[model samples]
Target chain A: MPADVTALELAGLRKSYGGQAAVREVDLRLPRGALLTLLGPSGCGKSTLLRMIAGFVEPSGGDIRINGRSVLALRPERRPTAMVFQSYALFPHMTVFDNVAFGLRLRATPRVEIADKVRRALALVRMDAFEARFPSELSGGQQQRVALARCLVVEPEILLLDEPFGALDRHLREEMQVEMRKLQRQLGVTMVVVTHDQEEALVLSDYIAVMRAGAIEQFAEPIELFDRPTNRFVASFMGVSNLVDGIVERDGEVSFRFPGGARLPVVSDLPAGPATLALRPEAVRLCAPDDAACRLTGTVAFTSLVGSRMSCEIKVGETVVTALVPRHGSGPAIGERVGMALAAEQLQLFAR
Target chain B: MRGGAMPLLMLPMAVLMALFFGAFAVFGFVSFLQPASGMPGYQGPLGLSNYLRFLTDPAALAILGETIVFAIVVTLASILLGYPLAYIMARSPYRVVRSLLLGALVLTFLSGSINRAYGWLILLGRRGVVNDALLALGLVDRPVALVYNWTGVFIALLHFTLPYFALTVFGSIRSVPVQVEEAARDLGAGPLSTFFRITVPITVPAIISGAALVFSLAISAFAFPLLLGGGRVRLISNYIYDQLFVAFNLPFAAASSTIFLVVAIATLCAFFWLEGAVTRRRAAKRGAA
Candidate 1:
């Protein structure tokens, strides 16, 4: 079932170290059993925000609530949350069984009950027969699984993950991503993941919170955030986007121009004014020089083969515009003169 | 040639080793040839009498007991004091604090044995600053006699060994990855639990090595015990010194010194074995996982 519970809430949270603010005025609403990802570049406060939510960092101002109960004053151990770190911080001395049993042991749970719960948690992560193994004996992916199992054994109200797969190889990272999402769904526990990788966020998050210097840039559903970014940073950060500077003439007749002299027709209802425009590289198509409607002309400067697609950089105006063409029969050679037409709807204009 | 140079380097030490070995061998052979008979002079043929006399002597037994207790107490105290100082040194934010600690450590090694013992002697004496404060504060009615006893010797030993313990343990603590501690905290372990469960266990090898070194030094300590003990407490070193310098019984003293060497090696080997066992246990646990 979809989470009808409000799992966690942050109200105007702020944190500063010494005198410098690391996280400022951050507020969020996380649904119970939902996975929320905070995405941004390094030092953008995403990790800081996640740390605050996990209670590792005490917010200098504002409050946090878990399961509708205020947890602002609680210590990390007292808070009803657990964090999985990027380094897979499994205790090196303890066996997998003991590491998973640590939380239950801390709570003074019965030995038999602790054993049962650890066994079940390990099974959930599909790591059932590895109980006696120390963390050092496992591979990177196995260690990550052990870490996840350790966190889940606690059955906390929320699980906070700080780039849990950041240390894994690409293949293992992707596999863990799928496995983590499945586990989160199966157990119906809320999860908050922090990562700078936009693709990982898009793959795992129900809601993506894009953070910039000490503030949230935008927070919305993954599809909405990617398709309609609120600003240039989000647009460029989310994926490959071509930004063209231009001025709208009047009454939705928009013409987008690059740094050089080349211009392309764009669709916008913005009043006649200077503006910025954006288009995905895949949205533009290569055409013969004769087909000039809504077209920009330039010399094809460089070409790179990416899988089955070819990306060509065209010197349009004073800016280099890239277009990704499907590598079908034939395509333009480097230095070939080309005209690229942008689909009218694909070009988006905004006020500068 | 590399092989030729190897033998050249070994030759000097080898000759020295042979001479040292030859002296001990000759002493042993001579000790058996003539055994001590009356009030304490060799007069007869080879027998087990010399060995039996030394092992059964009450004074010899007391020295052995005192040496073991001293080694254990000094080793324990060094580890207790050094672990916290090492932790602080490894994590202190200010470079000046680290430099000050390092400066203090260097000062520990600055003075000769007599000078360092004298410093300890003054502080621990009944009329010294420590007892003066105790009486002035009414913590005691009279100045307590702390010097010229085992307590005085222990204080001196602790002073001599603490800096070495700190320096060695500091290197080990520094190598403990900060990420490990952060991971523990993130996993909901409190600060104290994380420290004991993670940081302390990982550095056990260093602690064992440091303890073994301190124990060896404490057992063999001569100047500190001789100066501070002031004829009250007799350690193995003092006993050996009296046997050699006062009694001039080279064979008996050699036998006692050889026993001390064997005990030291045994203590070191025991600690190394314990550390190896713990490591193997951890590795086996990982394999099971």
Candidate 2:
């Protein structure tokens, strides 16, 4: 294998079950040491795509190459890939040391080398002291750590994770995510994570492949995915709620006009036609109804303090415009009148 | 569903236990009594005469040894025949195959044991179906001696217990999630290694229980031995039957029955002890983790 070759590649990956395609035409190239997340809602073929890469699910039409070598014909264990199952399928009968040493023993590795590798892998995941413990004795998060050590001990070419932290609580999940990110960086292992949580995807991935209906919607950096979604599905799926449907026009400067006399000038090169204006909730600054910078005015229908920001749902005529403002500075009380000013730099337009 | 009904249900269970326990107490008392004198009005003073007779007699010792051997052999043979079937029932991909195999097994179990033994007798006897086929195919010069012997008794007992062993093992195997096995494979274990290293140890408790059940059943078996043994291979149960009914030696029968009860309880207790050890280890493992 060439040094510069991609660590894992899926070319024209297609899978169908009983005449219905589960994943279709998904092509990906993951560089060594880069964490890529396949982000999608459940049943969107994201898990299927990850399983295909792991060689657990055989593709109906595709080639999965690891480090420039095709592994399509290889079994899951034979592939240079390991997966941390979502259920953290740790063996209940074996201690953590034996579980981590299982792969090495399968290859008939020397007994001393197996013990050393198992210990190093456990220490990498900070599970060194828990080696004698069985999985049944561990918490969900500790079980996941052992699972990671079990996979990492093999020193696989790539590690596939299927919602690895989905079982933990909010605080523990965040803690584990940071721990896993640090471990991944320290070891420099290419990782492909499958998750439905966009927040998790953003926090952990270098790039995200947003999938919908067995196809990739957008494959880009996390910031690019959040800030510049390519289509209406991507816009709504990314949790950007201000997707105002309207038509684009060239009146000296291109502007969009919606029903109820609402209009906004869109700085875009889109041809004059119907389009959707997407704005992030945080991109809208709140103002008084009489403020000149305010483009829309309405009474605040709902308000909640989220972290350091106040999330307000302002009823701008028929539309509910969500605006996040700092909680310290006059957070909108329920039923209070407020206005929204859109940030032009953060605005995105897509064809309806 | 009322809790009150629980105590009511126990009433009948208590009565049944009292009835059997009282009879067993009478048997115990009888075992300590002398053998019947010329008169049944009163035997000699209470003594361990029948117990001494049983311990010192070579014929009784042979019957006891044969029972243990029969139990061990049949238990092992049943496990060897059952574990694969159990694994297939638990892990087979096709629903029809698993259901059909289980259906046949359950159906065989539902059929009376004596009927099944007779069914086998018709198949394995000198002029039975198996001999007929072998002779028709010219595979044997003469009909093999399969029935009216220890082989017949062993085969019949295995047939009676195999479904039992397989069912228990199947439940144990099913209790284990498929992902655990897949995890073993994902961690680089091949199919054989996964089964031996992962599957077998996890299901050991079930295997032990199945072995205990088969052993106890085979040791105390009467119907299969009576019909199949054909007076040639008498087990402890068959000998006890003769001691009580044919020889009219009630004290000796009572003495041997008490020993039989002790042996059965001991074997089952050993299995339960093993099961508890496995469970405790699992609990300790979980607590440590």
Query: Which lDDT tens digits does candidate 1 get at residues B1-289?
Result: 6757788888999999999999878766655534353334555556665567678998898889879987899999999998988888887879988888878887886767788888887898888999999998999998887888888888888989998888888998898777677667656678899888888898998998898889888989999878888798888988978977788675577667777777888988998998898888877766654
Ten contiguous residues minimizing lDDT sum, candidate 2 chain A? A1-10
Docking class of 1: medium
Q: What is the TM-score of chain A in candidate 1?
A: 0.92
Task: Please give, for residues A1-352, the per-residue lDDT of candidate 1 as tens digits.
Answer: 5557789898999999998988889988988889999999999988888888777677899989998899988877788888888888787778889889888887889988998999999999988878888788899999888888988988889898998888988998999898888888888888999999999998898989999998899999998887777777788888846876766665445565566656666666677777777778898798887785637789899998888989999887677888999886667888888888777766667778
Give the runs in model 2 whose Cα sits over 4 Å from its true position. Answer: A1-4, A287-308, A315-317, A327-340, B1-15, B37-42, B273-289
Residue B125 displacement (Å), model 1: 2.1
Q: Model 1: residues >4 Å from true position, as ranges?
A: A1-4, A261-263, A269-273, A288-299, A333-339, B1-47, B92-102, B109-111, B280-289
Model 2 interface CAPRI class: medium
Candidate 1 lDDT score relative to the true structure? 0.83
